[model samples]
Target: MPGILGHRASLPRQLAFRFLPDGTDDAAVEWTYHDLAEHAAAVATGLLRRELTGHRVVLALDPGLHYIAALFGIFQAGATAVPSFPPTGKRALARFLSIVEDCAPDVIIADTRLADRVAQFEAELPASAARPHWMFVDDDWFRRAAGARRPDGDTRATVRTDGPALLQYTSGSTGDPKGIVLTHDNLVSNCRALEANMGYEPDRVGCTWLPPYHDMGLMGTIMLAVHGGWPLVLMPPAYFVQRPYRWLKAVTDHKVTISVGPNFAFDICTSSITDEELATLDLSSLRQVFCGSEPVSRATLDAFRDRFGPRGYDETSLIPCYGLAEATLYVSGKRTGSAVKTVWLDKAALENGRVRHLTAEDAEDAEAADAGRAARIVSCGEVAEGHEVIVVDPGERRQAEPGRVGEIWVRGPNVATGYLGKPELTAATFTARLADPGDELTYLRTGDLGFLHEGELCVTGRLKDLVVIAGRNLYPQDIEHSVRSAHEKLRGAAVFSVPGESGEELVVVTEFRGTARQLAEEIDAVRDAVTAAVTAGHGVAPADVHFAPVGAISMTTSGKVRRDATRKAYVQGTLKKLTPAADALPLSVR
Candidate 1:
């Protein structure tokens, strides 16, 4: 497959963007390959004139056509593109500043709308930090850049397809965000892998509401569409969050055959979409609806299918997959036309680092289907072509047994080079060798825990996020899921282990909906329900059940709950407590 810019000349007239600003049909603006190429050329020329060809150019633009063009423009200019969203608040600003400090980019791209915010953030940067040249994407700036004629001797920089093109940043769900160095080859390889896994068809259209800064959005949508030469419908992430139905409505309107989102996206669409909204959607055209970027929930998939099945949404469209920033984007995904494959494993055996089958028939034979004892593990399909995926015992640095849960290590063309500047940390993470003899490959040690069954990968949980109590391993997602189900008003939950007098104890921080009066009224009842659920479901009671207001839980750009950050806030006693007494309840006896 050709790199992003390589497609411009051949597919100049090819439909590139059917962008819906308001996530509605009336506000749609169409852009072709020619339009993108022309816009990108101007930006590239501007960067070249500024002599930033070999420098890192941070894209702190909004999520739309201008951002997309600036990204490709950086690529065309032979500079490293550092994709990022504009900072909205103190937390987001802090994260943005961290990226700037790490990359030390020579230029930062933005629009006039964010001029004030960017100025404020730049002013706050330490005197030691390098001040980047800010180029706004507003009318005045674009006109200046686009209209300026290049010098007589000046020519387009040789875009390095095989060299470093992007410094894709991690979501910092477990720790501080790190820049993942991605070359054009790596991006192309992943896009080709996705095309192979999710077979393409004629007139295929893609839709995504994912944030453009993330890999899944950058590579999966914009880059993938360019690689596949297909049209893509894009909407702002805020629009999707505010009205998820708009995502589906765009799909229906565009005849979208492929789309992608995280597990929470499906959950929101399932819980929030109204009956009238559901009736208006016709998802029959969708053949591939990827649910990834976080743990794929079986319940979320089932609910989405059940709700939209009547409206022509097929269950097979939901492809539960796995990938991380280290491996570019795609690692493994279910192939097109294949039914969703799942395995029911004994929860206890899984916690012990073993995979024990608790098949569907076994549940039927039992008097009652106990979800607490069995976990449904979804298949992320076979490893991408030309890629090798192995489950390795992280501690022993050896290949794990066939049915054992361990860290997922991958080696392939899609795997990124390493972190931007952290050589020692990058070497440790990106270069790992198995204890097995005769294996010369150095794998990217993905900190994800999972096992392989019949060539399909089944992700269990994060290796770092695993909660250990009395030497027993527990997955926090299970506990969080149980807490979410504990009350009707509960929104989101973060489960983690905090230091205790004896050992690490479980702590629960959950978000609740409704007014302050309602929260004060339901605090005790909700706490009791959560305690009972966690104890009964996971056999471990939470040390502190902190009921927080909605949106209190820290989340990554990709909608993943930042457990580590939340834990830090919780430890510092900074997390807001919405309880009547403003105190976390101790483990209550059910």
Candidate 2:
């Protein structure tokens, strides 16, 4: 809180949070530096009336200034904050309860819009089960906060640095949501590290369409603005989903310097926008477009730059980053103002744990002759100043060579403590040391595969999702990219591994917009082309190519494909497959 409200000697005195509800607007709700402290103080006093001190409180509010103030208020009241995706459906409510059970929160704060769903969820819990008290944001609460007998600013003067700040739950892509208990020190450390790595400027205006519930959205943009003393414009992820142009227009309208989002968002802006819609976007003011939260795609960056370069968007503004919720949302990022780096390599050599740079002739021949498609790896960036990013050979319990692929391990002051209520799992994942007797640093195994090139971090794929066939190790992302590039039908699809008679095989699961009846022959063509493109790209044909309904392919709240559960559903024959009758379709993992 010191960095947020106080210590503003050299920082800019600007608006704290500007709430942009949608993409197009004539005006927005603004809170200046003084306004934020006063409102946050009032919000904290309201929490005290609910007796939330030292208790775990769930925040399920929509993305806005209220949510930002509520977060700081939770800290002011000494309550452990647990931000969750606002329950939107039956499935979402079930997962929301799962998080509640894991964190054991006492109070849940949400918008009045979600009162019905919250009430229904509470009624369904067993008599003996734990249920959190719901505190909806109604008109009365606003009045109470505005007239609150405000708490003293010095009340949290002695807050412990190691005290639990919040529990950031995983998105449940690999498994059910697991809570990571991060301390105050962890949050401050990571935020400061981001400020340093990103070359923070107090005068810079920040913007983000990321949802507040996710780690990158919560800590990276919203909190970073407060802690670093900068102005910020906030918008909802739903708005961006509906109108991708609004995201860029806000940056243009506000002259934003730093903005954050994943790679797919860039792809959507490039592909989904119409010629008329693209005409309104002006991104010349954007300095750094922090691309992260999933695998960074080189093609996505290239497409976005090529599409918008005419509108004064600098190609160097696109900065690739890599990190996870476990590390407080930032591990490594490229230097500010540097051009992005991408390397072309031989696909076969990539599978054998080596990076053999592809010459211009080799790349052209691969693309033209169909002998093999060259693999393009984008460097996330050089490691942060105070953080150590290592490539470890999980099998040999040692560090991998400079150019060899291995599991990514990280160690820094920014790393969070172990997951909540899971001592054994925490030790196994969060506290691992190298086999060398002289080293004592404990690194968090990222469960991701990558290598170091010229001291830059190069991410390949997830270890659990890595596919091995015929003595070759293949990254599913490489295959997924090939399928998507081969045809538009496979865009935004997922590739995973399944058990095979030989070793492990590839499974491509995706959703097609049209029905079997509407698509007819085109659907059949897509199936054959999917198998063929994968064979040419990876040197092995997919065991099966699944086409399900638009919503059948489940994703986490933050939009990561749930490959493990997808594979399990495919094995159990539960996916609602289309283009072929379910029982008639011939599909098997082995």
Candidate 3:
């Protein structure tokens, strides 16, 4: 099996970037295959000089060309790369420290720009934590290392095919982050599976503004482009957040044929981009726009199409895919050339762990087609080649019946061996087996609730995130979406269950987007609307509707609403209340 490093000599010199320091594409940096290879070789020389081979090297740099160089450099030096978010502020620094403690890296490589913050982070490290060697990548270091060459031997022999290549950490939406151990074979196999599943053209150009530290950005885009031998234009996630239009503009300007983003990105583009900006985009060149890392919203997909379709954005270009860090990113992606498929099912039946497709007759029946009775689920396409995906009854540890929602289990070369340094968990999660006889393949339990409809995977929700009240399982996303739709002022919403006098009660924490005066005037009305929406949609009224300050809702790095974390904040009374006046709604302190 050829690893990523093997492509160093075979790939074309085309990957480029438009450096946007001040949100302007003034500096054009075109990095070719040779350029990246040479830079990576120099970085490898630097690492080898430090005797850091076969060690964990954590990257704490901004998303850019230098980060890519450092990643391949670690591969060339036979060291495991741990891509991490830069410790820019208190929150990020805390997460970074937690990752450092978890990985216990031998060295920490960061950009020179983070010198001050890095020093502070180092000082804050606990006494029990091992002090890691520090190296900073900058123009000066690159200049000094440029003269160094690859070790005198067959360059391909530098990295073992089955050895650990990366420690891709989870985003920790549910719990603490765990490093998924991906070997060189896993990386190459996943990239190949992506290519096999989603046919890649040699002349294809890619673009992305996703955070490079995450799996979708690193393996899905960066590593995939390298393996596919294509050019990829890059930009920081902050720039995209500053203006969602920049992402499409880059796609249009570069004639990008492939791109990837989460569901919130399309929603942001739909609501944020003006008609003037929409007119400037020519998204017809995009053959596939992969959406994953969170639930793919039907409303978002339809709205994005309705808004951008006139501007040549192909409806068929948006592909809903399913994947995670444990699968080395690309799991299963919708094939191109067809519009995305969505199945409207009875919400009650779905909540009961069954797939009941809503028929036209059901729609005609007024009582049956009540508001929120139908749940629209988007198909995540077929399993990748050489992979087996099965819905397993988690409790029974047996294969789920047809059309029954269960934990998605995957077995393939793309699946990672296990979580790093956790044997028991690794066995429990990555070595699952069915109860049926004559079935011997070990499967990785995805912990996602989904069922196969026809041949397509329709993900319902996460098993742990499901809210069971009165024996009815409610997906938080459905409740959150309803709450957001309840009022125009409602922006971000998180729905979770809390211990009540009863078994559990639903709590809604939301952020409003209007002035404080406007909120004060509409506070009572908004609360009433939210309560009605949740009650009508899920048959469960929220015990309390709390209006939080802007940015109060906890979100994962990949833009998922961190319901569990937000619940913790709600219980601790740490959530910032949106109090406009004396008559404002009182905080429902737990």
State how far residue 323 of model 3 sits from its true place (Å).
0.6
Per-model TM-score on C-alpha atoms = 0.95, 0.93, 0.95
What C-alpha lDDT does candidate 2 achieve relative to the native structure?
0.79
> Candidate 2, 222: how far from true, in Å?
0.5
Give the TM-score comparing model 3 with the true structure, all chains together.
Answer: 0.95
lDDT of 3 by residue, 425-470 (tens): 9999999998888878799999999988878888889999999998
TM-score pick, better of 2 and 3: 3
Candidate 1 regions exceeding 4 Å error are: 1-6, 116-119, 151-155, 173-175, 365-371, 581-590
Model 1 TM-score (2 dp): 0.95
Residues 1-590 of candidate 2: C-alpha lDDT, one tens digit per residue: 53356454234566788888765555687888766665566666767777777788888877887787677777877888898877776676777777887788988888888777766877766566688888777446666767656445442323567888888888874235689998889888888888887775656999988988899898889878888778889888888988888888898888898899887788888988788877877888888889988888877887888899988889788778899988988988888888898877887888998878887778878867864678878899988768998899999869997668899999988888989899988997899889988988899998999888888998988988877787798887667677777667555577877788877777888777776554453665787888888887778888888887777876765677777777788889997776644443344311
Better TM-score candidate (1, 3): 1
Please report how far candidate 1 places residue 225 from its true position, in Å.
Answer: 0.3
* Predictions in order: lDDT: 0.85, 0.79, 0.84
